[model samples]
Target chain A: MTQANPATLHIISKSPTHQQLYRDIANALLDDDAILFIEGGVYACCGTEATALLAATNNIYALSIDAQSRGLANTTPAAITLISDQQFVELCCQYHKTLSWF
Target chain B: MIFSILIYASSNSSQTEQSALRFTRAVLQQGHSIHRVFFYGESVNACSNLIVTPRDETNITEQWLTLASAAKLDMVVCISAAVRRGILDGAEAKRHNKSSANLSEGFQLSGLGQLADAIIMSDRTITFGN
Candidate 1:
């Protein structure tokens, strides 16, 4: 009955509260989904074990601008697709809703 | 699309509330129906009528009240979150032996169960948190 369209969650915080939110939501993700990493959330795409686990689903994307700002453009895990701000906005329009964690 | 927004940060110090409000207006302008706006965590304080802002600053509580009133939107604040943050309705204040309550108009003190129900009934449940 939960009628969400294909979701595209954007996470921009690295605080404990944000981290717990990520954990809870990650566990609840369905096969039909995508995650867009931005701001501090770029850290989550740093070739960590969690990133590896999430990459297994093939539904994650990283914001290129944020990665470049944080000097992590080249170091990001290869599994993540680097997307532009326009693509981010397009994704927002394409998804039924956006859950912001920041 | 019918959507429900969950606000989980404080109104004063965090941009979460402001961003959620902006998104609500934009979504409605985009021809979407907002099923509800659920305030939780520190954001429950957003329902407190006692929120006083500087003359130069925008009164966020008043803005929320006005928007809900104009749109006849459902504004629900989590009771647990409200109680923890010292925000109570008239009835709850009496039951809890408080002096008075200052809950803003158009905002009702509710429960997380409503959030769960909204998740089930709404087309989308978008959360704004910090």
Candidate 2:
């Protein structure tokens, strides 16, 4: 039997306000792929933009340090898990490849 | 699994470079091996020795150099990107007749072939900076 494609880890560093970036990632994301929010991308957790992402996959995560630095720790939606730098590394290892979006 | 890293953001303008550094440290700490780190676009600025950070701020280039030395990492800066950005090594500076070479130690200036090699040789290629 042919093997299935491995899941990818999508790392987004731009804010959701970048509509083009959000649309691009949304279109590119696979069902089994994971989404990781870092830097300004953590802002997505505070708004409604991630609702569509949550509908797609359960493996959504945001970098806790980035969120906390942005004062988003308290406001983050429950669907997305806050991860550490170590966990970010682990996620990269788990995925087939990491695609970084700005 | 062996991994490669691609850095494409501006080291001087964004915090993404520092994030990449922390992630790299975590990867090393977890006993994972890195195949190579290819710096491209504005990220090649990190390979310049002339960048001076204020005493209170972290010198990210120095941090990368220290980590690279400790880990014996293969850090390659894109030649085309480096040249246009004025991040030249001794040879490039001499060839171009520039005033001085500013390429930082522990980093080598190479072509995009190294990036292609990293992609083909490594199990996964993770990109940091956008």
Candidate 3:
């Protein structure tokens, strides 16, 4: 509801050290879009290169369930906002389109 | 809502195929329409018939075929990835001079354009796997 065209990018993997997944995600995201990080993907926001690429991304969200379980609730970068499971569904609804990267 | 699925992991290794199967079932149960299922990377291996499965284990290929047939779903495997992994359809097998094809039933081989088309036509693109 906040933008004319909202799309949610969901990341769910660690991408190992190769980080091809990170490069792929950086190339895939569009402007004014929000990213939902869950599972091992919460690790993505902590990297230095990831922070640089995330500058172009409008909103970055991490699932609180995964964040809490991974003990990353308080450790994530300031730009990443943790949201509830219900909010994850709400994000999918609000965006009308979601691209999951796993 | 209309949904499109992307599978990137192999049936032999990753949990993507099983997860995709469960998600598709849930989507259908929820009364949503699936525009297409696009198989990329190692996931294209699901279209091969040469894989051996133990009687006790869940056959991921069969699960996808069953869903595709029952729902009349449009399942597409990326041609670029398929060729690299030796997942050839009858035509591709003939073109490549292979003795036979290994593509399982209920799946089609197409280009990345089909994936782009799926994304453009569907409401959401749900990916499973790394």
Candidate 4:
């Protein structure tokens, strides 16, 4: 069973090839946990390298600014939700805890 | 409420240090306390007095030092992370047979357990990274 309060995962690295971190997140996530991609991390929602984790992950989000900056605003798959900075702050409080991976 | 802050990036790269600094200031302005500030990964580099900032640029390390002094906060740099990056305190310098110690005046080198304790004891633990 997962802990009563599971930490939400936040990834900020831009590199899509850090397969180990993605694998770690996949292995650690629980049903109720959320995953957020900010800065260069928005790349996690695209390409074959990301397919497995994206399929396993639920409640995935990407910062709107980062997505727009990278021209991913329109092309990012529906699996990822674009959130504003205000929403980012709200999400921080909404989750019991936050673990940032870079 | 008491807050624990975790910083994982070096002052040289990313805006992690700035974000953590602003958040810490706001936390104090809101009348809250910071139980601990744990510097892990590249963030351990921020504790060194060895850095030289440009004349026109804001000294992020000095900003932290001033804020930490004013707030009387407990700041720790992870020993494992620090030594790996060449941050040594007096004792560590002696043990490692280093020429000198460069640990900033207000910071100390500790262990990962301090991070665990900060997480357990503080009301919230927020991280700032790349």
Candidate 1 lDDT over residue span B1-130, tens digit each: 6778888874555656765677677667666788889998888877888877889988888888788888888999899888878998989999999999988878889888999988888766877776
Q: Write the per-residue lDDT of candidate 2 for residues B9-93, one digit (tens) a residue.
A: 8665579888888888888888888889999999999888989888898888899989999999999999999999999999999
Q: Mind giving the per-residue lDDT tens digits that candidate 3 earns over B1-130?
A: 6778888874545555765676677777667788999999988887889988888987888888888899999999999899899999999999999999999978999999999998889777787775
Q: Candidate 1 on A1-102: residue-level lDDT in tens?
A: 233466555554453335566676667566666777765677776745355338436767777876787788998777788887556544666676666656
Residue range B39-126, candidate 4, lDDT tens digits: 9998998888999888988888899889999999899999999998999999999999999999998998999999999989976788
Candidate 4 lDDT over A11-78, as tens digits, reads 54555688888777777777677788876688775676766666665778887877787888898888
lDDT of each candidate versus the true structure:
0.73, 0.88, 0.76, 0.79
Fnat for the candidates in order: 0.38, 0.91, 0.41, 0.38
Docking quality tier of candidate 1?
acceptable
Among the numbered candidates, top TM-score falls to 2
Q: How accurate is chain B of model 1, given as a TM-score from 0 to 1?
A: 0.95
Span of 10 residues, lowest total lDDT, candidate 1 chain B = B10-19
| DockQ: the better of candidates 1 and 4 | 4
* Colliding residue pairs in candidate 4: A14-A40
Deviation in Å, model 2, residue B81 alpha carbon: 0.8
Give one digit per residue, the lDDT tens place, for model 2 in A1-102: 122458889999999889888888888888899999999999999878766776788889999999999999999888899999999987877777788898
TM-score of 1: 0.67
What is the alpha-carbon lDDT of model 4 when measured against the actual structure? Answer: 0.79
lDDT against true structure, model 2: 0.88
Q: Candidate 2: where is the Cα deviation over 4 Å?
A: A1-5
